[model samples]
Target: MRIVHLADLHLGFRAYHRLTDRGINRREADVFAAFREALDRTAALQPDAVLVAGDVFHVPRPSNYALVQSQAELLRFRQKCAAPVVMIAGNHESVRSADNRCILELLTAVPGVQVVTENPEAVTLANGQVRVVGLPHNSLSRLNTIDLRPDPQVPYNVLMLHGTVDSSRINDYGGYDVPADLLELPWDYVACGHYHTYTHLGRHAYYAGAIERTSNNIWQEATEAKGFVLFDLVSHQAHFQTLHKPRPTLDLPTVDAFGKDVAALNQELAANVAAADITDKLVRQKILNLPKSQQARLDARQIRQWQTQAVHYLLDARPPTATLSEAIAPDIAASQGLTATVAEYLRQRELPKDLDRLHFVERGLAYLAQTEES
Candidate 1:
């Protein structure tokens, strides 16, 4: 039987400040468009079943527009494909309080769709030929307390879960974790979510990855193809299909500004920006080893003009270290801005081999930027 595996849709995810012609957030519109494309392709493939592991929405409390648009798309999928679509809730759609309802529960009203908001539930599909055991995102207490083993009654079982398997690689964004031993469970296939990059854990287990760029690490994930997997249960094999072309992102090489006058620094920055095609792409330019005096003298108006030409531009500037005499005093070192210090500290730490340190630091810096703005 052919089964399509997809996860981390993040339908309502928003970024930058650009707005579409319809007055909706540009990023939100991009995400919604990507989902529509995926659904369109799924209908064409005519799979027996479509499995959506988790993170259906960016947040548990999505806007009414997001809800209405998603419902329309899902109903269209049901009408066009006539196939069962099984979905589970991820951390983004999980609610902490019992009184608070998970927005995913709204999807239960849609025909040909099954929404699993709680863990340890099994749903049979294809006239009992396939048994899918779902484990949705849950609190740590619930994760530890639940029974995660596969059902012995079914030989063709698929384990669907949204959590971290390798504890060593935990994301700052919250997610429940299961021991790596869980991957060893007796199942025909294991579909995982919560990680935004496609990965093959074993012959059968896989992460389909997000449909579009949904995080600050867009530059890093840009290198990886963004798409879904078509898993053939009969043959125990999977094939990835790219859903959409990702938005272009350019991370320019760092420029050292030591000893360069304001005119020289401006010339270098202007030349680098001119060399790259940043017209409609997300771009980042960093100037390092600059002194405070040089930064003050830099032409702010020209930088603003450069930013206007691109869809989104980030200009990061780092100041040079103090002189030996100034370094002798602890106060001078501590005087650096909190955001700058945080970046420096993260740069010094030894991160895990699998983790991209540049992305990690970039995310941290993004958060810091948001905090400062708020």
Candidate 2:
């Protein structure tokens, strides 16, 4: 069986406040473009099945544009391909309210598509030649209650879910630490999501990753490959398929501004900008250890002009050591840090009584450090 494993489409996600002539957010448009491209290319391949691990939408309630585009594109996909598609509700779309239905459930109206919202289900497809076990984000919480064994009769047993697993490199975190045993299952293929970077967990397990960069952490994922995984069950090979013209989010090399004055800083910043193809890209340049005094004198007019060059530009001029706190603005930034602020926010927000907030934040923070700059 040939399958296209895709995840974290994150439709309706917006960032950097960029907009197109049509007034659609540029990042949102980029995500939509990726979905269209992935579907179009998947059709060309004519895979037997498509596995969308999770996070199909950035949030539970997507915008009208997202809903309309999703319906239209999904219908378009059905028209071009006959493969069965299985999707689940990712954390982004998983709500605490039991009264509210998952957004993914609406996609079930489309023929040849299966949506798993709150629980785990095993769907046998392709004339019973394959078994797809779908564990949505909420279902992950009840892992012990569910059956993890694969169907012995099925030729191919595939596990599709959203969340993170405990790995050697689990420190740079994002999601709850799924027991490593989850990946130890004997499924022919295990498809995952949540983390934006495409990851290979085991011989048959993989995170197809977001088709395009989706969150504030796009800079960290700048170097990692983004695309869906095309797994050939027969050959036991998972091929990474690249998307065409994914919007560039580049993290340019940092320029040391330790002792440089405003004049020297301008020259340094100008050189870095000129060296890269930042046009229409989301770019960031950090001049580490810049004096607090020099920061105020930066030529705003020149910087504003540079900002216009990229879709969005950020010049992080970190202040030098002189304070009681070594941390630089740690709240949501690296100086004070992303973890504490996010943890504090979580404490303020409502959570399930059974949920362990401390553990939840720590595990995700492990992978996030690598993916996000905080």
Candidate 3:
């Protein structure tokens, strides 16, 4: 059986400050465009099944635009491809309150689309050719209770989970770690998610990366390609289907300004900007060991002009006189953002049964991000 595996679509995910002409967030628009292309590509392949690992939405409650576009695009895929799609909920869309239901369950409204949001389900397709076990985010958190054995009756068993496998693609914080021993299970294939970079964990397991760049530290994933995985379980082949280029995100090489005066530093800056093609791209240039006087004397007008050439320009000039804490503060915060910290806190805290933790934490993080910008 052939299947197109996709994960971390992150629809409604927005970054930076740019907006589309229609007042929709530019990054959010980019994500939708990539998703459309992915659907188009999947339709062309005409796979027997489409498996979405997780993080279908950036948050538990996605925007109206995201919900509408996703429904339209997915329904189109079902109409054209005539295949069944199995989607599961990741941590992003998982609600902590037992009273409230997961938003991903609503995706089942579209025919031929099966959503496994809460419990574990074995979805048999192609009249018993394949058995896909949908292990959602919360279920993986309590792995011991689940019966992970493959269905003996099916020819192919594809295990799907929205959690981090034992790989470098694993994030430093707020990740659901699936043990290495678990991957050694005798399954035909394991389709994993939550790691935004495509990776081959073993002979049978693979991660289909995110469709678009959704992180503030876009440079961290500069080398990793964004796409989905097309695996033919019969032939034992997993091919990565790369999507069209989304918005460009570049992290220019750092400049050492140990002894250079203001004139020399500005000259280097001008040359650096001239050498790079940053037009309409998110660009960042760091000037390290910058002298206090040289940084102060740097021409603001020249920098402003450079900013005009790109979607956003970051002039990261750090002085040597700064304290240790001051130097690493931003890095610390970026490595574990307000959202991630809240996630970690929730995991450790003993919360009230009536509290809606997902809404409370996500709202607080949004407010904190806005305040930081202000």
* Best candidate (score: lDDT): 3
| Candidate 1 local lDDT, 1-374, one digit each (tens) | 99999999998898889888888987888888889989999999999999999999999999998999999999988889988999999999888887888899898789988988865688999998899988888733476676777667765799898988766544326887766777797888999988888888876899888888886477666467788999898899899989764566787766777556789988888888888878877788877766777788888998888778777888877655433222222563488767767776567544458999999899989998999999
lDDT tens digits, residue span 233-333, model 3: 98889999988756777788777675567888888888888888889887888887676666789988999887887877899877654422333346655
Error of 3 at 291 (Å): 5.3
What lDDT, from 0 to 1, does candidate 3 have?
0.82
Q: CA shift at 162, candidate 3, in angstroms?
A: 1.3
Error of 1 at 198 (Å): 0.9
List the global CA lDDT of all models: 0.81, 0.81, 0.82
Model 1 ranges with Cα > 4 A deviation: 168-172, 321-374
Task: Candidate 3: list runs displaced more than 4 Å.
Answer: 291-296, 321-374
Question: Cα miss at 110, model 2 (Å)?
Answer: 1.8
For model 1 the local lDDT of residue 195 reads 84
Clashing pairs in 3: none
Worst 10 residues of 1 by lDDT: 320-329
Q: Report the error of model 3 at residue 299, Å.
A: 2.6
